[model samples]
Structure formats: C-alpha cells, structure tokens
Target: MPEKVIIRSIISPHQRESFTQFIPLSPDMTREIGRTVKEIFDSLGGAALLKSSRDVYVKPNGIDAKAYCYTRPEVVRAVIEYWQSAGARQVYLMENSTQANYTRVVFEVNGYRDICRDTGAIPLYLDEEKTIGFEFTGRKSIYDGDPRGYDRSHCEMPVTVTEKLIRRRDENLYVNVPKLKTHSMAGVTLGIKNQWGFPVHTSRGHDHNYNLPYKLTDVLSLLRPDVTLIEGIEGTVYGHYPVTALADRCVKPFRVLIGSLNVAAADLAGAKILGLDRADVAHLDQAIKRNLTGGVTGLDDIELEGDFSTLENIDILGDKPSSGKYPADLFDFFPWDVKVLKGKELACREGCVNNPLTLLQVLFHDHNGRGGWTLVMGKGFDPDEIDEIQGRVLVAGHCAIEEVAERLVKRLGKKKVYLSGECNDLAATAEAMFHLMKVNPVSFLPRRRGAAVLAFLMARLHGSKSRVPNPLSHLIKMV
Candidate 1:
C-alpha cells in the first residue's frame, strides 16, 4: 500500500518566480518542501527510495515543444534537485516526444536542454535510444489506452519500450512529473496519462488509440513509478477543441500533486484537484476496475497529507469541445498558416479531422516557418485546387502528391512544392515543411553520412521508425 497522497496548492500564479531562473531556495522554504517530499517517498518505502547507484530517470511531460502544454523546466529541476539532495548518485531526465525522430529538439526547445545543463541531470531522448519489443502471450494489452474497453489479459501486446530505460528499471527509481493537461481522448492526462509515452507504437501521431485506456494500464503494470508528481502550473482545457489557438487551450491551475507506491492514487488525486469526476476519466476508471490503483474508485478513497483545502476552487475547464469541432484553433496556432485547411470532404476516412488537423500542429510546433505555411492536404483535392494555393504549399500523403508535384514545381518553384511519400508520414512531412519553416534547432550536431547510416542500421535492429530512410538528404545534416 502507498502512503497518503499529498496536494500542495499555490493560489497565486503571479507570485511564482521565473520558470527558468534557478535560484537559491530559502532554507526555511526548502526544508518545508523537502519535508513534504520526504513524506511522499516514505509512503512508498523510505528516504533512500530515490537513492541508487545507477542512473535515475525523471520522466516529465514533454509531448511537444508547445507552450503551456508540456511540463515546465522548473518542475523537473525541482525533482532533480530534491532527488540529488536525497542521496541519489545520478539522474537522467527523459521522455519520448510525439512523432519526431529528434526528441532532442523537443527537449531543447522546451527548456530541458538548459535544465539539464544547470542541474547536472543528463537528458536522455528515449526515441533516439534503441528499443526492445515484448508481447504478453496470455495477456491482451493496448498501448494508447483506447477507451473502447478491450480485455487486456487476452490481447497481444507488441509494445516497444526503450531498452536503455527498460534495463535500468531494476537499478534505479523513476519520478513521473506529468503536466495537468486535457487530453482529447482520455479526458484528463494526469499521472496515469503520463505512462502512455513508454510504448514506441502510436494509434497515430495525435496520441489517441482505440486501446489507449488499456495500453496505459499495460505500461503502468510494466514500469511502475515510485513517485508521480502532477504539475498544474499551466494546463490546457478543451485541449482538443481550440477556440483561439494557444490562448483558449492554456490554463493556470497554480498547484502541484504528489503520489507514490500506487499510480492510481496519484492520478486520482490529480483528477480530484482538477474538479474532474473519476467516472469520466477512462484510464483511471479502467485502472480501478482491474484493481490496479489499490482499489481507488474515486478521490474519496485516498487520504491527503498536505494543503488541499481548495479542491473545489480549481478551474480545469471542460475537456471536450466547448464549441464543437473547430480547426481554427489549430490553424491559428501558426501565423504563416492562414489559408485554413480546406477540402473538408477529403478528410481521411479513418478519422476525418485526425490527420489533417494534427499534421498542422506537428508541423508548426516542430519546425520554424520561414515564409510561413500554406497547407492544402488530404485525399479530397481535385488537381485544380493546386492552382489556387498561395505561398509555399505542402501536399501531404502519396494520394495528393501525384497530382501536385509537377504543377507545384512550375508555379511555386522547385523549392516550394514538397511531397511526402507515405500518406501519413509525419516525420517525412515535417522534414518537408521545415525546409521552408527554417527551424533552428537549439544546437546542431552535424552527422556524417557514415554516422547516419550507422544509426539507421542500428535502428533497424530495434524495429524503429529509423527503419524508414529519410528522403530529405538535408535531415541528415540537421542532426
């Protein structure tokens, strides 16, 4: 059994200091916070719970480089600072960003690069590391935690996790610092939601799988976290449905949640603080059904240890679409991309808004727009639509690639029309879009062709996305 969960509420968002400024903590304040953190570990085991001879991993929410959506560097730095002071010998900050080969890009852009430099915590990009695949024969499990409800024990689980991270499971501890964000599918992305990053598979680039609910359970069962910290300094509401780009999605909850020895207790506490019902959070409810969260059916089941008086005052906003499906939130995210995604009739049959809308998010967040973007994508466009496109146009997928290649070259110029081979090749698509975006990585480590070939071949051994060769020759130069 885990110790009682702890909730520390910071009502004043404005009073908080620099998110990146690492300063000397007042001895009094440090001791108070440290005492609270020590109790959190005592619930799991003892003060040495984080002490290890090998590398410890501080897993934070860095799904993308987007602002107010991922975990803040200060939150991660606090964890590193605390664990090191608590007798930890070494620690590594790690996470797998969505769909980008360059996990380093996400970390560097989102402030982890500097966090690692100042705190002496190494940054490990999970996707860049080698992966190992496993399948539970008698147990059926999903990777993305699909809410459709599949029996985990009977499903074939081909989940791939970073071998470097998996092998370290027995040698060290993990502190999962998940951001309090509203997920499009699983409702609230709390402690349990953070584990979804372990699997190397994807329902799609967008982070929603039919089996996400169960997939999350499988990951939790596999790599159990010793401490789960939920940060609500900044969050997203109606996260999937954007009203006005970045403004509508973000929220300032001004709070922090801590839990351990049990993942369910931690995430349950997170949902409660957000004023969310346990019944509504699919993975949390599913975790309860399997008796995974120590039989925590709701927040009332867990005991709180710290300041939690303002549970009701917390404003999480709605998780679902507040105003129904709106693409403007996504399109408006980038200033260069003003034409708005047309060809609604051409949305992929798999899921109408999934590919088109998500592609725009991936492109803008991952790359820098030079001339900005004018995207016209999906299966619907008649070749005639190509003539109407302005600025640099990106025609995604092989479906649209065939029609626009020649026309785009002639009208826009050879540099303008970018074609991706696979229909949903986000990596390839990103490489194309970025050529025009002129994205500047935090630091560039130029790799020779031999190095790229060596990395590519090694990835082949691990069944990685690197198995697919990048057509953009310059991408090899970018790394």
Candidate 2:
C-alpha cells in the first residue's frame, strides 16, 4: 500500500494581522510561518527525513512575483532558516516568472533576492541556468478518450535538473513553497503550480495549456516532492499578475501556513482556505482523476489544524469558481470536447487578446515538433494579403473583412480558409445557414475571437498561407 498522505496546519492568532504598515511582510508574520513548518512537519512524520539532507530546493511560487501575485520572500526565508537548522548543507530558492523585465529585478521587487541572501540560501532563476534533462516516468487518465480502461504516460521526458542545488549522493528534499492564489485557468495555484518551474526554458509554452491546472498536476503527479508549504498570508484574489492587483483591488489576506505530504491534498486544503471550489479547478480535478493524490477522498486521513469554518469567511475578490456546471465525473469529458486538447486554441479576429490554452498549445507543439503556425491579424473588406504570398493560409476565425469569404473564393481562390477559435461554430453555422439559403451569409464576428482571426489574417499577409490540415479540424469539422 502507498504511504499515507499527511497534512499539518499551523494557526496563529497573529496570522490574521493586517498589513496596514505598507510592507510586503512583517517579522511577526515570518516567524509565524517558520513555526508552522516546524510544527506540522514534526508532528506528521519527523524532521529526521530531512535532518541529514545536504541540498535543498525551496521552490517558491513566483507567478511572476510582480507584487501581490507571488509567494512572499519572508515566507521562503522563514523556511530556509528552518531547513538550515534541519542540517541542510545548502538551500536554494528558485523560480522563473514571465514578466518581460529582468528576473533579478522582479525578484528584488518582491524581496525574494534579499530574503535568500540574508537567509544564506542562494536565489536562482530556472530560466537562465543550463539544464540537464533527466528521464521520468508517470501516468495520466484519458477520460475524454477511452473509458472503462485507465491509461498511463511515462513522464520519462528529459527534465532539467537544478545544478546549483545538487548534492553528492545525499538524499534531496524539496520544499514546495507556493503562494495561495486563485487561478483563472487552473482554479487555484499552489504547490502543484510551483513544479512548472522545473522544466527547461524552452518548455515554457506548456503553461498556456488552458487545462494547465490538470496538465501541471499530471506532471507533478509523477515527480511529487517530500513536502508542500503554502504562503497564504496575503494572496491575490484576482488572476496571477501584480498589475491586476492594483487595477483590480481584489485580494484575500489569510494568515495561515499549510504543510502537507500530498501536493493535491495541500492544494485542495489551500483552496478551501482561500474559499475556492476544488472541483471547479481544472488541474485539481485532472490530478484527482489521474490518481495523482492517491485519491481525493483519501484526504480524510490528513489532519486539519485551524478552524475549517474560517474558510467560509474568505471573501474572494477576484478569480473564483465558475458558475457553469463543473464536471462531477472526470470521465465525463469526451474525446471531441475542446477541453481534451489539454490547452484550447481560441481564435479571434486580432492577436490582441491572449488565449492561454491556444498560446500554450502553439508553444508546446512548436517546441515538441507538432507544428508551427503563423499569427495573423486584419479587418473586413481589406484587400487580400494572401495574394502576395505563395503558400496557403488559414483564416482561424471570421472577422468583418469586407466579403472575406467571397474574397477567399474570388481573388485568392482558396477553398481551405480554416476557421477556428471562438465564433467558428457560430460562423460555421451561419455559413451553413447561408449555404442552405444559397447566398453569402453575413460575417458573424464574435468578441474575443480577434486573436484567432488576426492570426489567420496575418498568415495571409505575411505569406503564412500553407496548405496544412488545421489542428482543430477533426473537432471543428464535426461542428
């Protein structure tokens, strides 16, 4: 039988202290987290598992640590101090954020760099270092594809190891330290979300997977760590960006530190603490479906320390569970369903709007030898730019280009103007309706479909026209 999952909670009356002083964290707050880690780990099993560890990797959830969206430095520092006492030879805290600015600056802004230096733990950027790929084996369920039969995928892909934190033949313990926050895509990001930092810089595109919460959890299901610690002191209730925090003053300040042996259990518990619905999160559901947590129901064995009732009072000011009917049965997701794509490819008329799934899909496929597509953007009634190109083009979605269909049929003389993205169904339905009527249908452009539409348009303009089958054709054609 698998070892029993363990979770320990540390509740301090002081945790509820407010940050009225305009600092990111307080000394009292830091000490509280350290005490929590020490208490929980000590009670669950013991510190002996980590006592002789020579190297430690404190993976902090950077989520681009712009401001309120990431794991606070103080929380990580507190953990570092605890690890030092545990006899860890070297402790390294690391993350790779997505902001265009320098990682060092971003780290400093969030006070992570200073915390690392002060605590004698080295700060590293996963993106900048030279990565060595290691083979890993893991499994995932194909609920959307084959039912009644479970499936597995070996995570044996080459993974880049952190060289700076490497120790000689000594048992390595990972302390997953992530900030508590609501995710628009994953539902909630905690320990599992922090593991995305382990891959090489090239694999960066996997994050765009719309079903990232699940995909990420799948990845972690194979490489789960020894423990997880979450910094829930002051988390962004809004999506995972600092700019959004200021523009949208929605964040929850929960003074609780969570520790768990099971990553999913920790996230599920963390979600409740943040007052989020675990079922609503795509990744948590996926992870559970794939048996990533041993079983979500198995969480009954873990201990809960703080007031479970307090979770009810957490006011979610930003990202919250979608009101749409969440899939109760993980197997309910079907093969043809868009959600099965891992990440979705949403088409828009212009490239302005960013669709996390489609963006991630393109990046993953491109990096992993799937296919490379061009980005297109344009408006209706515009002269066809494909005329200048020698290859074929895919109009990912319809835009109000003056008789674009007519133009594709007229000037360009191409029949394969692939329509994908948001309004493809509606546009295709409208086209079918017009085909039934035997006349050109009015161009129906949906809002937020601009990104797909623009990709199509630009592909036409910049000679992105190549006669390749649309990735979403099997799904879209059925519609």
Full-model lDDT for every candidate? 0.55, 0.48
Q: Write the per-residue lDDT of candidate 2 for residues 366-416, one digit (tens) a residue.
A: 222122222232233225343443222334333322224455546545443
Candidate 1 whole-model C-alpha lDDT, 0 to 1: 0.55
lDDT of 1 by residue, 134-246 (tens): 44221233344643333233221122233434555666777788887665556677778787666553323322334456566666666667678776655555443222234
Model 2 per-residue lDDT at 321: 49
Worst window of 10 by summed lDDT in candidate 2: 326-335
Model 1 spans with C-alpha error above 4 angstroms = 1-3, 11-46, 51-55, 136-170, 201-208, 240-245, 309-355, 358-425, 428-479
Highest TM-score scorer: 1
